[model samples]
Target: MIKKLLVGIVIITALALAGVYYAIEQAKSYLQTPLALNQAELVTITPGTSFNRAIGLLVAQGWLSETPYLRLLPKLYPELTNVKAGTYQLVAPLTAYDALAQFTQGKEHQFTITLVEGSRFSEWRQQLAQAPHLTHQLTELSEAEIAAKLGVDREKLEGLFLAETYHYTAGTTDVALLQRAQRNLERVLKKHWAQRDAALPLRSEYDALTLASIIEKETAIASERSRVASVFINRLNLGMRLQTDPTVIYGMGEAYDGNIRKKDLRTATPYNTYMINGLPPTPIAMVGEAAIAAALSPEQSDYLYFVASGRGDHVFSKTLAEHNRAVRAYLKVLRNQ
Candidate 1:
């Protein structure tokens, strides 16, 4: 009787071991088998999405098809509960196990948008509204409303965001991107403001930003920024009107018809530096770091005026006569064209 009992026990143990080995082999094969995908698909996982919901999403992508294997996936691997939320690109022929691993590892897709220097805040709004996959929260909000919502007490929005390429995941809110840009601008502005040249006629950091925006619009030439900034600084010191066409254009608002008539310059408006005594109420456009530096530490020169040389550059002048000559030369170039 003892011998028979021992044989029964040994047979039961061998059967259990064979079953374990078969289950492991089947699991390996199932994990290694690639899914039937023709091309890469983009997937968005929201925050706190359950494993069941994720599986459903995979099924929606035409993979697994509610197979028993998929049903058992969560029970088989309960430790994969902390899947991150992001946009992910799933490539074709990826195995089920590999897909799960990708989710678990949080390999999210990144998108980018560039805020160009010298762009007006209105242009920034249009670009943000058109950026793909970003949650548009600023569409209906006024610039002042946006500032209030973002904890900024300012009445305007120009020059608040730094001009640069910002990378983010799909589902990031426009407000969040704006916050990043504002913080970046604050940091840079603070640093440059602290290092500014002494006895500048500018009132504050905002003054520097305002001036920088003007400088940015004045010329795109890298070497011309300081000289242009110097011209403005010299004008301010001598109590002369800025007489900048860009400011006049800004003051004209939507009424500007791509042409700056003599009447437009003569018109009095808050933003028209020709009529106003100092910097405008706010910046006219987004400014870059180079323009900011130029505003803070302008090149010391007798230049009080600048006119476009028609070569995508500007010619600086010390006197009104020189500036008039440069203007005539530019007009001649335009007529010759």
Candidate 2:
């Protein structure tokens, strides 16, 4: 009787082990082949969802080979408890076990959005609205609203962020992300500001940056930046009007006809450089680090006047006569007759 009982116990243990071996073997066979796979797709996991919902989503999306195996996944593999939430690239035609492992390990989706240098707040607003991954609309947000929402000061946001492509997931806060951009700019600017040449007459880093914004608006040429910086520094020393064309353009607001007529320069506004002296009350546009550095450590020169010589470059001059000559050359290019 004892022998018979032992044999029965042995049979039951062998049967359980056989079932375990069969399940594992079946799982492996299904996971290895690429059998009529569907195209990979983006899956968004919203906050406060469950593993059951994820399995349902996979099955509904035709990604999983077996739906019943979903509940059994955590039991078969203990790592499923560590799955994270966010956007993921779900690859189709995957075995249930393999899909579980993939999701359990957590793959986050990412995208890049650029905040170009010199973009106006309005332009940035539009860009934020259009971004696929970013979740905030900062362009239309009032300065006060942005400050309240992000817990930042409204008046101190000028030139806060770098103009470059930033990487992020979808649903990133526009205001918070922009704040990060602002922090990035501040960190970089401070680092560079410390290394600036000590001989400059600038009162502060912000003051140098203010002048740099003006110089940046003056031209587009990479080589012309320092020369523009030179002319502005000279003018600041002599206490002369900036007399910049871009400032006139900025003052026009929405009414600007894109043509800077002779009379437009005469229009009186706070942004009009022909009317105002020294730096404008605020930056005309978002300036880059190069412009800030150039402002702080300007090229040492006696040049007090500069005129665009056409071809997207400008000619520098220390005298009115030299400037007038450049003005004629640029006028000739514009006339082309």
Global Cα RMSD, each model: 3.2, 3.6
Local distance difference test, each candidate: 0.86, 0.72
Tens-digit lDDT track of model 2 for 88-175 = 7656565554555666666676778888777666677678788886776676667667767767655645454566778887778887
45 in model 2: Cα distance from truth in Å?
Answer: 2.0
**Model 1 regions lying over 4 Å from their true place:** 1-23, 33-40, 47-56, 63-81, 91-95
175-200 per-residue lDDT for model 1 (tens digits): 99999999999999999999988789
* Candidate 1 to truth, TM: 0.85
lDDT of 2 at 203: 69
The alpha-carbon deviation from the true structure for residue 201 of candidate 1, after best TM-score superposition, in angstroms, is 1.5
